[model samples]
Target: MDGSDDKRLDDTLIALRRILRATELYERELAQAAGLTPAKLRVLQILSGRKEGNATPTAMANQMGVRQATVTALVDQLENRGMVRRERSSTDRRQTHVVIAPAGVEALRSAPSALQQHFVANYQKLEAWEQQMILSVLNRVALMLNAADIEAAPVLTIGDIRQDRGRG
Candidate 1:
C-alpha cells in the first residue's frame, strides 16, 4: 500500500484498539465495584439473561466459545459463591445444568454501568441509516482483523444469542 493508505489503516487500527481498551476498563471497574471479577460478572450476565432455568455445560461452553473444562471451572467458582447452582436434568440424569441463583440475579441487576448502556444510548440517537453504516463498517473492520485467525468465533453481543434462540 502507499504511504497514505498505510497511515489510514494504522490510524483506524489504533482508534479501534483504544475503543476496545476503554470498554475493558469500564467493565473491569464495574465488576470490581460489584465484588466480582470480570469473568465472573460475564457469567452472571449470561445466566441472568436466560429465561430458562438451567444451562447445560455444553451450551454454556458453546456460547462462550470456551472449552467445557473452562466453563465448568467458572461455574464451580460461581457456585461456591452461591451465585449459581447445579441441578441434574430431569430428562437425563447425566446432564448437570447450571442455574442462576437469586443472588446471581441481584448481582447482575445491580452491577455497575456497562459501556453498552452508554454506547447504545448514543447510537440510538443517531439516524437509522447512520447506525446501519456504522455497524457495517465495524463488522468489516473486525473481519479484516480476524482474517488471520479464521477459526476464531465472532464475538457475541449481549442479547444476540437469546434473540437467535427465540427466547422471550
Candidate 2:
C-alpha cells in the first residue's frame, strides 16, 4: 500500500527468485556430474530411499507426485542405462517393481548433494531459536504461496514445475 510495503514486497520476490535460480543451477550441475537428468536422478534417489530399494511405478508416481506414465518413462530410461531393473512383484503378478541396480547406488553415492552441503553447513551454524524462526517463516511462506500441498521429499531438487502445474 505504501512505499515501505512496496519495497519489502519487491525484496521478498527478488529473494525468492534467487533461491529458485540457484536451485535450478545446482540441479543442472548435479545432473551433469551424475550423467543423468534431474528427473531420472530423482527416480533413482526415490528408489534408493525405499526399504528394499524397490517400488512399483504407481507408488513412485505417488511419491514423486508425478503421473504414472511419467514414472514409467523414467523407469524405462533407467533400465536402459542399467541403473534399474523391473521385476514382477512376487505377490502381485500384475505389478512390476523397479529395483535400483548396483550402478545406480554407486551413482547416488558419487553425486555430491551441493544443496544439502551448502544449506546444512550454514543452517547448523544458526542459533537454535534462529533455526526455529526460519522454519516457521518458511512454512508460512509456503502456505501463502499455495505450496503447502506440494509433496516434497527430504531430497532437494527443483521438481518438474510444468507437471506440477498440470496437477493443480
Candidate 3:
C-alpha cells in the first residue's frame, strides 16, 4: 500500500518485456542462422536424436506435446526445405515416418543452441521446491494475462506456436 509498490509493478513489467524481446530476437536469429523456424528445427532435432533419424508425426506430436497437425505442418515445411522425407513404414504400410535428411542434420549442426536449452539447464539445477515455485508463479502469471486457455508447447519460440489446428 505504498508508492514503492507501483515501482515494483513497473519493474516486473519491464522484466516481462525483456523476456518477450529476447525471445523475439532469438527467433529472428535462429531463422537467419539456420534458415529454419524454431518449430521446424525442433522437429529435425527430435528425428536426429532418435533411432534411425526418423519418427511418425503422431509420435513427434506426443513428444513435443503438440497436435499431430502441427507436427505434420512442421514436417511438411521441413520436407519442402529438403530437410526431411516421408516414407511408408515397412512394418505397417498405413504408418508414415518422417526421416531427417542430410540437410536436416547439417541445419541442426549449423543452428545456434536454442534458448530453451539454456533455460532448461538452469531450471534443472534449481532445487525442486524452487522449480515448483517458479512453475507456479509462471502459471499464475499466465492466468493473470488470460493466457491459461492458450495452447503452448514446451518450446520457447516467441511466435510460430501453431500448437493446435484448433488451439492445441
- How accurate locally, in lDDT, is each candidate? 0.69, 0.78, 0.85
Order of models, best TM-score first: 3, 2, 1
lDDT of 1 at 132: 98
Give the alpha carbon lDDT tens digit for every residue of 1-168 in model 1: 999999998998899778878755765566566656545666777777778866887887787776677678778877877999999999999998899999888877777765666777898999999999998987787688775444332232321222212211
Put down candidate 2 lDDT per residue, 5-124, tens digits, no spaces: 999999999998988888778777776677665567678888988888799999988887777887887787778779899999999999899999998998788776757558889999
Relative to the true structure, candidate 1 has a C-alpha RMSD (angstroms) of: 7.4
In terms of TM-score, how similar is model 2 to the real structure?
A: 0.67
Q: Judged by lDDT against the true structure, how good is candidate 2?
A: 0.78
Give the best candidate by TM-score.
3
Candidate 1: stretches off by over 4 Å: 1-10, 116-168
Of the pair 1 and 2, which is ahead by TM-score?
A: 2
Clashing pairs in 2: none
| Clash totals in order | 0, 0, 1
Q: Write the per-residue lDDT of candidate 3 for residues 1-168, one digit (tens) a residue.
A: 589999999999999999899887878788888887777778888999997778999999999998898898888777877989999999999999999999999999999999899899999999999999999999999999999987778888765565322211
RMSD of each: 7.4, 5.0, 3.5
| Residue 4 local lDDT, model 1 | 100
